[model samples]
Target: MISAALTVEQRQRLVRVARGQEDGDLLIRGASVVQPATREVFEADVVIAEGRIAAFGPGYGAARVVGARGAFLAPGFMDGHVHIESSLLTPAGFARAVLPRGTTGIVAEPHELVNVVGAAGLGWMLDAGRSSGLRVWASAPSCVPASEFEQGGAAVGAADIAEMLALPSVLGLAEMMNYPGVLNADPGVWEVLEAGRRAGGFGAARRMDGHASGVGGRDLHAYAAAGLHSDHEATTPEEARERLRAGLWLMVREGSAARNLAALLPVLREGPRRAMLVSDDVSVDELLELGHLDRLLRMCVSGGLHPADAVALVTCNPAEYWGLHDYGLLAPGYHADCVLLKDLAGFEVLETFVGGQEARAGSSTPPLPGGGVDLGAGWSAATFDVPAHWPVMEVRPDQITTGMGAPGSGDTRLVVADRYGRAGPGQTAHSTCWTSGTGLTGGTLGISVLHDAHNAAFLGGTDADIRAAGAALEQLGGGVVVVAGGEVRASLPLPYAGLMTDADPHAAAAAVGQITAAVRALGCVLPYPVTTLSFLGLTVIPALKLTPRGLLDVGAWQMIGGADHN
Candidate 1:
């Protein structure tokens, strides 16, 4: 049958090929093709022409035929949600790493970069992703500054949303982390949503992603009712089920900070058609060690999920939710993207083909892959001050929270500063708090991954250590640095927006590994020290958090006395 997807010129050629009047471009012979939609498998010869499946049968002929040797041929995988910048590699380098793992498409959110450089930063990301020869579609950043309590480099408004949503490469609005705005009927929230709708009219689906973490009851309903269609923050099965019942697609994620696959995998048993898989955030080390979406797929399948169901979550389900009709399938007229797997149990990819060309998985180098991240001048400068009388932010090896402490209490100090020049030159917002019992008796750790905000966060047992650490980080452009006894102990330079490195994934991972070890030696027991410290700046998460503006009492949804030096 001639695929309706064929163009006028391609259709004529497809007709001739089916009639045996022309030879197809390529053919994979002797493979068990898994049709994810129908959950069926059939041994067949799949033929390709003009980068589309032209014919599929045992007798099909083609100019190039590769014997599959009974491998399992499945549709190329898709990452429903991801932040490519977290990998610390440029989009092209990131593609080189993950393409071998069978990821053909990605739905990315460049909010991290947007937080650092605003919309202009997103433009560079879009161009790099497109030039990589991978399908990299982004969602308009729904919360550029995230919220009022935090200070970011840029404040993206309704105008920004409308402009970004209209881009051909943009899928829709990204996860709106401001659930309070939706429930409270905030004008700013509505303005952004309305703008998204108007601009998304050019596409088939007007999608607004959600970030309602830890919210439940009627608030969940109201938030979903506000036109949000999908969520990746459902950490528990109860939350997943509730969101699913409320008509929100649940994206079960397993990333660097949190792993929700085990908690939410049960929802899949209920035949949750709306469920998808995502890695909202992942570190360079994690990507190189495990993989992208392929890692998540292995977990699902190994945990006893039906192979077809597991595959559907990454392929058909995400494609449908994102309205990407041309991808996520191995059918007629679809792009000739396929993954030849060694087996379903491990989902080990033998080869990945995109547009009928085999993707190459090449080696990478250190310091930079493709190109080095640009670090501006005056990076080594550090200007900060802490009041003598202020509440201390106590840090346990397990958690970080605020406490009341007196001078000479041996409490460690935590400080956050705006690094993006967002608040004018030399006018960066700064906040400091004291803390005890973190066990870091004599060193400082400074990093740029002030989560959600991508600011600069410094933690130290002594004032001098912190000062030295900050200077060291600035010298490296933007990265994590550990200092003790007035000397630099270890560091990792992430020159990309002070958040990510342009180094090779493996090399970046190694650098981060060294920093992790150094921070651990400085008395941090958290499994992911860099990630845990980065989250300190994320005010949206519960319990307690610190922003460049000041300390935030998340439960109360208000700023505390980190700014008020009483």
Candidate 2:
């Protein structure tokens, strides 16, 4: 409700009365205030002046007044943790959709996109953040390249962390995802952590966040002990409780497929109280389908969590953890960000205000038009072509060695059988891709990633076809490519770190969708999930997998010879 028609004196009077000061510049009469301070609801006239709360009482009088007879006026919902990139909408689009859902602030990490464009990408975000009409605090991603396992766009080193910490809007280091480095006391990781501490020491206590997925027990203890202040990867109730007991602020998360919020409600209902709600990654479809943090609030109510408790989770808990002082609470010296809701269960929004101005005043919002998001293209398809070097002696024998594995591990051994029959990688009584005397996969597969396994092994009935895909993709550093029947089928150029495309998300997403349809056309079948060939080198999941280097016995978390892993 920003009006030049409303004089500064009026806004002043409203603030005075709303804040219990001498006189308000403007006052909103007959409204219910969801007091975060006491976790209770009360009805009163809210007054505002100069974009701040002036006063709030039944006998409120000001230059202007907004009648709020029936609505839940409370601190705007703040997503304690989120990734705008994961939202699949540009920041502007991201805000446009969520603001109407009563999301007033977000604590976000630009790490996902940062790996692709580096500092330039970050600068674009910082500038756009200023105009979003919402409070956005940047967390300098401690792991821009995520892990040394997979490649990414751009790089954020020690110096970059220091620089970001110095920025006013940057609220300390983003989650120090490199928990291994922290546990190992790596100099590079600490260098950045220490720098943020130094720069953010005075104004606000900037913190280094954490992402220890499987880290538990003493290591978890030592991790919390070392200053990895918060975590969001606890997948189970037990995991959440243990971390909380160990003193790590558990940012109990609820993302795409991982929903840990309901199970962890007891933690919120119980204990010494430092819990917050986070939407680590909400796709654009999900934003439209379900909602933003507002969805979280309603879920809490259904899960038997008190409405006031739900409000506290979204409001005060986050501000306290990240040391975000101003925007989370609705009080005298706080940022005037408030959401008018219909009820505790319905959680419908009637209006939203930031700094005492109505940014959104309806049920729905349009897609955000992100500023400065550059889609760097021009990476060619030739990059995904291959075979600079090959072990040509690859005999037409019982088994073949696919050349994608960990750097020091054995290659993918393709086993050929005397008979034209062998079970697939699974359902073989033993999960081996080989049949004792029969042929391996009836078709061919190309070399790509095996995720944490880091093996670039190709799949397919024929070795040559597999080589074609692997060779083509590897030659280009990294990107998704498909070749079949000895011909290039389709490809997407990820010039950034071989992981992400600099192209706008929409364009990149479209290209990816096309590639996926093409891959499906090739008739490849697996009992897993879909990804842009990015999770290839990962070794965490159990069973057979491949990487840039070779095959892996996931049960062992180690590389195995293509012929056999045992």
Candidate 3:
């Protein structure tokens, strides 16, 4: 997409085209333009000149014109918040998958990559986004390690944040997962928040995002008071209402494992002024099988939301929140980023235009560098040994949050190994525990896609199977793997930062499907088993979680028991 800002020459040309003094570069005729701001739809002709909307009416001259066939021409959809890494695809690969589905812009947070490879990872993503044919704005990752309780490959301090904030593409601070630190006025957290605030000294003030899962009342107020502008972790109408009332934008998230859009629809219906739809973490399979923002629009309209209102949520609403004044509208002088939809109810995108140019899948840019995994050489089957008395983390079906299980109970064994070699000389690099509700009876599932840290994690019925899975991951560099009876069953390699791949979307989705099916064959029942397993290592979420240090009691903000290792 071309830059939103117009040059002097471009602005002059647009004015001439609007007044019919000069021919426009392109003209879209017979389109039912959907006005998101006015909540109305009307038939008109759209004139595009110098990558900006020149006018809207009939009898305009242009170099080229295409018939819309009475299709709905709406402002292209924009994702309010997303982690590009969660798609298990590089920024380039991610853009290819979503651009054809009607998402022309996104506010991406590279925390997942930062957690695994630090500031360099963020740079790599920014460079990749430049040529992805998508308008990618970044929010500097606020919590690289997510919290002090977990160990990540690298740490991003206040200085690092200040440096990132100076970049033009970086809009604000990413999700503040360390809510406890913010509430207690932790010096480090305050310093980082202050850095974001200071960036606006020379320009518009930067914004901050929140990740307060299950936080409420005075705590939520305090979080908002610290200049946090939005939250995407609300899973219920009540939660959504509280965040909205607290003066924070509500990003109603619907992703592979956590489907909260259906439950939060009431809040959006009540008042969509501060609400926008976001895909917080979509997998390749979900992106290919269902769709992107288009899928959310279909669901919202089907659930009784007015078609215009639903379109506004992904268009005008997000554009306003992000201070993108020149986007999310079809009026003259706005950037001509639009989607040609077959109908409002279905929202089937026939063509997507970014800055008046047709967008196509795949990138022309070279792939970014990979190779972030760094497990030490002493790994073996003996690394899986753990006492039966260790606490077990219980996986909640279709949710990222976990629960506590009886010690030594359940058929599945869990292990979190530090892939960055961050463990000290004497401290064990791996932690062992048990888990229930995964439904795995006879195989091992190994993943390097663990949330926040991207560590190597394994779950299995036996130590030998776990060893087999680990070996396969080590050989593939980093990715997902399934093993049983000491043989590799299935795998998918994520070569970029051990969290994403540069493969085409279809190939990546097919690989994910094979891995999901393999896990199901071994008796696992979760709809997205690989995604569910990836979250087991997240230390910020509620109830129970596992980290390389040990099993974490999230509420208590400490390890549940003494470190369990071989």
Candidate 4:
């Protein structure tokens, strides 16, 4: 269950405990706390009781005391924007992966799951993160299917938006990917926004996030004027600067696929107040190897930002931006969430305390149990037909392009099927120009990770290989699968709407490593093949994207090739 915030009577009790009138629950001594408000560090003893900070004073007696060994204590880091589904781990699993790395708070956007299972999926996400030590602040998904270019597994309307807005766990409306809808004043989009505005009447924060990539000038100003608060889609210094000037909190994304940290560092100098660091989407392997916000903090410091400023970006700045009033600080009456760091340069988290209690090292948080949503078998494979000259989806490091690779190289075939029966339980195949640039020489890859829609997408050199891979994914209950020589080579089962697995965090990371190795053996030479493949179905990004219905020219917001194609 979600822990409740401190009540008035509880606050009064904490104050009495601070005065040494009663023994507190916990205490930490011999540590230097990073004071973000003043950019100073001072030695102090901290006292905690009833899940909130009691005081910062000398000789505070408690039922239990832990020696800090002179380590630096800083407020726990917060990921400003992330999709729990993108981690390929259930909410509890993702929490286990990041909590030890000093990430105690997550501003999660469950739009990916909502696109597949509707409002029930969003409820699952909130409940999954409820019992974990990490605090989850979910945002109501503003776009259910993400866009009209593709069909969603389930349709959620303005009423659904209003219902989620009234939820205590939902912070505000998630990233409004429908920027064109806003620009054109679409009535449907306005209905969703209006519901969120009315949710403020129920005492929810009235924040609206943004997603406007490569959009600047008056268009950007208009988007901001429409009441969108922040964006994580900025990829360049220029884009970041423009958004910062436009009054958008720039969430500098450093995800597994989209690595924008190096390029967006300059924005920290331009406007540090409004700049926050976010992973946006990170995989299990990335979390284990590079860590969460702690990794971002180290990169920022190495890139010439002061260590304290880096801490503020992940801590105070994000907490303030999201209006999490009780967190991101160690001062009196704040939540007792703190991270003990071994050093500034490495950002090594020696210990992490959530609500005055230290989480055990390397232990997986309890998984939220659930079954896979059965997308009925109403699909036909014959809809996939390839023409000689079709559009190609070329994959590069951390990005994709449509029809941009070298020609006459025997382009790979793409088949998208509405496995969820969104379009009457049928599958459609359309040929896209693809190159061996991604290095898949002799096999097929199938996955239900088609972004936003969570449909079955298969890529292969031959139709037989594609069919084998597709069947393998169906057998595994919807997840990533590789088939070669008409045999299943590797797979990972994402039972939850084809997005997250209920596996333990460590086991899931290990399985992802095996899948990565298997893909590499088949000549798939991309840095993050799964992540890049997931984005292939995302119609929000620029240029071209392939949806379950057909290939879409995102810029024009229409299908490519012909009106009747696919």
Show how many residue pairs clash in every candidate, following the order shown: 3, 88, 0, 7
Q: Cα RMSD (Å) per model?
A: 4.6, 10.5, 1.8, 2.9
Query: TM-scores of the models, in the given order?
Result: 0.89, 0.70, 0.96, 0.93
Q: Candidate 2 lDDT, tens digit per residue, 1-566?
A: 11123466655555445545565555656667888668788887776656666556666566666777767788888888887765444566566778888988887787765655565555556665556556777788777655543333356798987777666667778887667778778898778768767776564446778878677888899888777778887867788888888877889787653467887877777733867899876555457657878888888888887788889888888888777666576676565688888888979998888877787423222222212211112111112121223221111211111123233232223321101012233211011232111122333343222222112333333445644554566555445555666666666554333333334444555654555555566553321112312233333322333332233554344555332211
On a 0 to 1 TM-score scale, where does candidate 3 land against the true structure?
Answer: 0.96
Please rank every candidate by TM-score, starting with the best.
3, 4, 1, 2
| Deviation of model 1 at 226, angstroms | 0.7
Candidate 1 ranges beyond 4 A from true positions: 1-7, 18-20, 202-205, 361-413, 422-428, 434-442, 564-566
- Which residue pairs does candidate 4 place in steric collision? 378-425, 383-429, 384-429, 391-432, 391-433, 392-433, 439-523
lDDT of model 2, residue 169: 69
lDDT tens digits, residue span 1-566, model 4: 24677788888889989998888899888888888778788899888998888988797899999888788989988888999889998877887899889988888898888887788777777777776557888889998878887666676788999898878878889988888898889998888878877877765438888988767899999999888899888888888888988889888999987889889887785546788888888889889988999999889889988777889888888889878888888888888888999888898999888888885323233443332323334332443455445455666567533334433454456666666543333423333434445677778777788777777777654667776776677677789888888888878899777788868888888888887788789888878778877777787887667765566767777776632133
Model 3, range 375-455, lDDT digits (tens) per residue? 555556245666676667888877788887788676678888888755455433787877899898888889999988888
Q: lDDT tens digits, residues 160-232, model 1? A: 8788887767888898988888889889988998887776555434888998877899999999888999888
lDDT of each: 0.75, 0.58, 0.85, 0.77
Error of 1 at 69 (Å): 0.9
Candidate 2 segments exceeding 4 Å error: 1-27, 62-64, 202-205, 360-566
Model 4 segments beyond 4 Å from truth?
Answer: 202-205, 360-385, 400-410, 422-436, 562-566
